[model samples]
Target: MTNRADLHTLTGAYATDSLDDAERAQFEEHIGQCPACAQEVRELSATAARLGLAAAVVPRPALKEQVLRSIATVRQEAPRTEPGPPGGTVPRAPLRRASRWALAACLAAATAFGATAVWQHREAGDARDQAREVQQRTEELASLLAAPDARTRTAKLAGGARATVVVSEGRDRAAFLATGMAEPPRGKVYQLWFNDKGTMRSAGLMDPERTTSALVMKGRVGEATGMGVTVEPAGGSPEPTTKPVALLDFPA
Candidate 1:
């Protein structure tokens, strides 16, 4: 019996109809209750259909004629001479037609399988890219904390949760790390801003559900003298919609 993980991997093959009878039965049973698997199968099937349509092309007149002429020159296999029960020897024309049908079926299966593999590869690549981006951000935060000119300041939010910002003028970057953050009001998220003297520029929005987060700010430190956090509507606004819950001033 295949485990759920193994069964999940069969989605691509199942979409392509490349699975054998037993495996297909197992997968069909699995998909009946697995919404994720069913959704993936639907998407892959649609992709395969588009790929088939895109790959379609009419054969050139000369190529068609050449293939027909070449077929006459090809030698056909001899039919069996052994005596059969009642019908005797099977006719050669039907055997030839059967072989052609088999070849066409094999080609179709190959095409579908190829489409599945390509779709899977693209999904894996996107996952890898997201992972790479996360790793890069983590590294930047680490470097900012280690900078010789780095200065840190901490401020308490409305609910006693502490938010810390590390600003490094030499690195021209700042990082914000906080834990124990309380969830904002419904349909709201926490937004960060860089205070350039009296001017406040948007930094980025924090994931409201996360109690702990570490991130490098969006823009350069430049002339920004302070930072603040505020609760804003989901997706955030161009300007702060509420007073800051926390504020930190960069060390001189």
Candidate 2:
């Protein structure tokens, strides 16, 4: 039988259902006389249940067999003490202390597992969102390419470079391809522009290292009357900073 002081230490194991039959019976008898031990046991049991629910997972087919085999090989601790004639027996203080520490470790493992599961779930959701975004972009680009009225126009640049523009009939979408463009002077990049009437807007920057590159222009392509490319500072300017190396004008 576990004494009143030792009963408190077994509360954690009792709550987690880890205590052996004898230890459990002894703890229950002690708790009946100790209000504080009873309350603590109840609280710990509730906490363990919550942790169990959060960490619940389907076990593999062989898990049950593995667990049973493991239990069979393990040696069970002897009863702390035999009950006296009328009163309870003295508890093995060391064993009771070890049981409490063991229960704490088990709870910690469950908590950690629960936290890891939550993080992985969030990561999976983010990956799905990214995949959906890429798919949508792919579909939009495909639709633009399949448009019946889609047409391509090519322009020769000063340095034997070539610029090709593909525009849909509605002029709502466009793609630009550049090839053989000589590397820009140091501290400069090739910048694309869309001219709507007289208003110039930046499209995007070209890759300096690539001899061939392509860009799918965003926004309303129909609003632009013409397109041009110029060499500008590395990051590109808000407006054209140099004469265009090549330009393509759309039919009215």
Candidate 3:
């Protein structure tokens, strides 16, 4: 039941595969008939793929040739024959056949090594992308906090936990921070909402397993008057299904 506007805001997350299964399904259904959202998702997905590729290390053109050459040049040692009864030796497999087997084994090993190298490089690239994303979010959060019009409000929640919201209308963004938050009951999560007049809009969600920290909400602040948090089934509800644990009003 996510509003159409909030559903549209999920294109980026869907492109990055960041949405939980439920949210992903919801977005998928939304995009089936919405050409605009479908197009945006496609573009964002392509951009994300390009970013991943940008971080990948390209191997030298000659590297494959060198590996093949090395495999081709490998000398196969003769198999040792076991001693047999009465001054005779057990017959060994044909040298040609043994050599072919050895070559095949070498080729297989080389192929496996190549695959491992590629996998490692991709993993390194993913790590770099994650680091860059973290840095970018950190910078954004810092700017939001330092905005001249920034105002912060804190409210106590259940179990003595507290929520602190830093909002900067001038920047059209807000950040949510929490401390002493205990994990929600099994199968439930904390969902954030933007109070637009009396109509609440889905802000985003807090994963039950992750540490609740500074979160820059998913979309523009617009003229939202306040923010609130409610417990919802895992993956969140389109609207708040429970009483808000905490609510904070923006500074006038």
Candidate 4:
């Protein structure tokens, strides 16, 4: 049919067996070749089937009596009239009402499905981005570790802990490793900073839960005079909040 929207609207009625014989035959033929319509019909049918199963509860004896009493109190409404030939049978209004309700329910189900699908797609994209970041970091760390000119310097902290920093001046990169240092106080984190000449800049933050860990520092090591670690508030700070616990000068 040229009117795809009209044909598509028949899906819910067909799934619920609420369509007339002529309408049902037309949709059946259309669904056979229309993959999108076929898939929509399948999902709607499954949702309808689940609702049917859930509605199969045995009613209490009092429920039937209560319903009958409620029906007795309600006034019977007359159906709307439409133009038709004399002696012709008019379409049942209750059937039309049932089909409308069924279509509305199916539309709601389709909307919910669409929202969930969009959320899942976004979640998958975020996961892929995170994976890519991790892979890049791993490769950078490996390259720094394998550099032939890499040299290490060590500094002893106040609490007898040690911080070792590896650098490759040729590659303009560095990696920091800490050991035997107690975790920072609650609401605080350990952050790494690099000093280039007299200018100080943040490198990265250490994992708070980790007592011993290594991280490949960010930023070019151009004219870097030293590396230092400081305790700062959780999530780290733009500037060092306190003096370094350990500072190691790079070899000239």
Candidate 5:
């Protein structure tokens, strides 16, 4: 028998959906018999619920459009400035100083905004380039994930709508990297599973954004029965929920 206090400790992880298979089973066994543990889980879960509610109900503060309008006001003001009455003779010294200040302000704004835009452009370009590299390299190394000599593979998924997988292979084990996958719907996940015969074996549940990497926990020849990929509900189905998108059945 396990202590109820120990079981209470698992409550946080259980509520967060972070526990692994064996831990889940152990937690379940403890919670089922201990009403105290169940109540504690409920109380802890309620605390978490409050945290989520606090986050969601946070007032947007109505600041976004206001800030944008503030920015625009400055942009428009750049073109309009207080000047001497048109018919009056203006002092040349003050005019020169004003002109110099205006020119300096324009240059300062240009430098700041220009640098920002350039930086944004460079960052986006780098992301695209990285995505491309991940795809290309994953494609190349995917074939070797199960090969004894293979090293590593990685892929970046885009949106929950599309998919990408990268596998890095080595003699004893492989790393299956998942990236760019959108957050799963509330209770679902894109799971990692292995196929053995007609039966599907669980590898692990995917990460929230699908930027998850699941290391193959066990070693198996890539050429065995067949290697497959599937998308399943969040916690992961006892079995695959849909047809596979890839199969590592070589020499076909």
Candidate 6:
């Protein structure tokens, strides 16, 4: 149904009893022509005669000459080219052209369909890979949330003008999502940090597009009592460069 015209020859082949009714009728409609159907019928005649011969009795040896002479006469006779039953011309030339074109088109279409199917299969495989990576990252985040000695907190990281904080809590183990008035300079990244009383530990990295309510880092951490974000160098900084962009008072 995706391509109605494509089923014509297959239907023609089918209508001659080579295929069943559904496919035969479908292809006939697909061809949208009468000459194609007639050609298919004619081509099928020899095959039908072969089927009939299995049950036929052998002719007497004396009749062989008579049968041969009749065949020769039939071959020499001119084929009738009168109009068909519907008063339509029994188109011989058009039928040949249409069938050849239809066959060529079918072959070309089959090749294109095969290629498209392969490409889509590859794309689906790549998507599955990406999905697997995301699932792994979520598992890592889950482990961090379930740490037996885990400490939780939220902080509004205060930067130059405005700030945002990491909201890591509960089974979700979310991270820095919102932001206040601050911008990372060129080629710099916003790094997530968890301050345990005195030492600042890296939670992960954040990007402008990574800002979301359920934000989480692909890595895991432990004993994080407070959350902070800061403008760090390209990858990340060993320590916080500026004040906290946002801070959250996590539960002990």
Q: Which candidate's TM-score is highest?
A: 1
Q: Which tens-of-lDDT digit does each residue in 1-252 have in candidate 4? A: 325446755666777787788788888988897776676566556545322321122434665576688797989899675686587644444433344445544433332222222333367788577556654554465455445467677677778777767788889998776666889999899998898775678999887866665557878887788988899999888988798787788755
Q: Which regions of candidate 1 fall more than 4 Å away from where they truly are?
A: 1-127
- Candidate 6: lDDT of 147? 33
The weakest ten consecutive residues by lDDT in model 4 span: 49-58
lDDT for predicted candidate 1 compared with the true structure: 0.67
Candidate 3 to truth, TM: 0.49
Q: Which stretches of candidate 5 lie over 4 Å from their true place?
A: 1-148, 151-172, 212-214, 217-226, 245-252
Model 2 global lDDT (CA atoms, 0 to 1): 0.64
| lDDT by residue (tens digit), candidate 5, 73-173 | 66553556466677864454454334333332332222122123323335778857755654443333322332323332222233433222223334423
TM-score of each: 0.49, 0.44, 0.49, 0.47, 0.31, 0.36
| Cα-based lDDT at residue 80, candidate 4 | 71
**lDDT accuracy of residue 123 in candidate 3:** 75
Worst 10 residues of 6 by lDDT: 47-56
List per-prediction Cα lDDT, in the order shown: 0.67, 0.64, 0.64, 0.65, 0.45, 0.48
For lDDT, candidate 1 versus 5, the one ahead is: 1
Deviation from native of the Cα of residue 82 in model 3, angstroms = 73
- Model 2 Cα displacement at 165 (Å)? 0.7
All candidates in order of TM-score, best leading:
1, 3, 4, 2, 6, 5
lDDT by residue (tens digit), candidate 3, 1-252: 666546766765676677898888888998997786676566444433322211122456877786788787888788685556575532222432333233323322231232234443467788577556655555565455545466677677779776777788778998777756778889999888998987789989875864345556767789799888888998889998898887888766
Query: Deviation in angstroms for 220 in model 6?
Result: 6.2
In candidate 2, position 104 carries an lDDT of 41
Best lDDT among the predictions, by candidate number = 1
Report the lDDT tens digits of candidate 2 across residue range 162-208: 77676785748776766667888888998888888877788888767
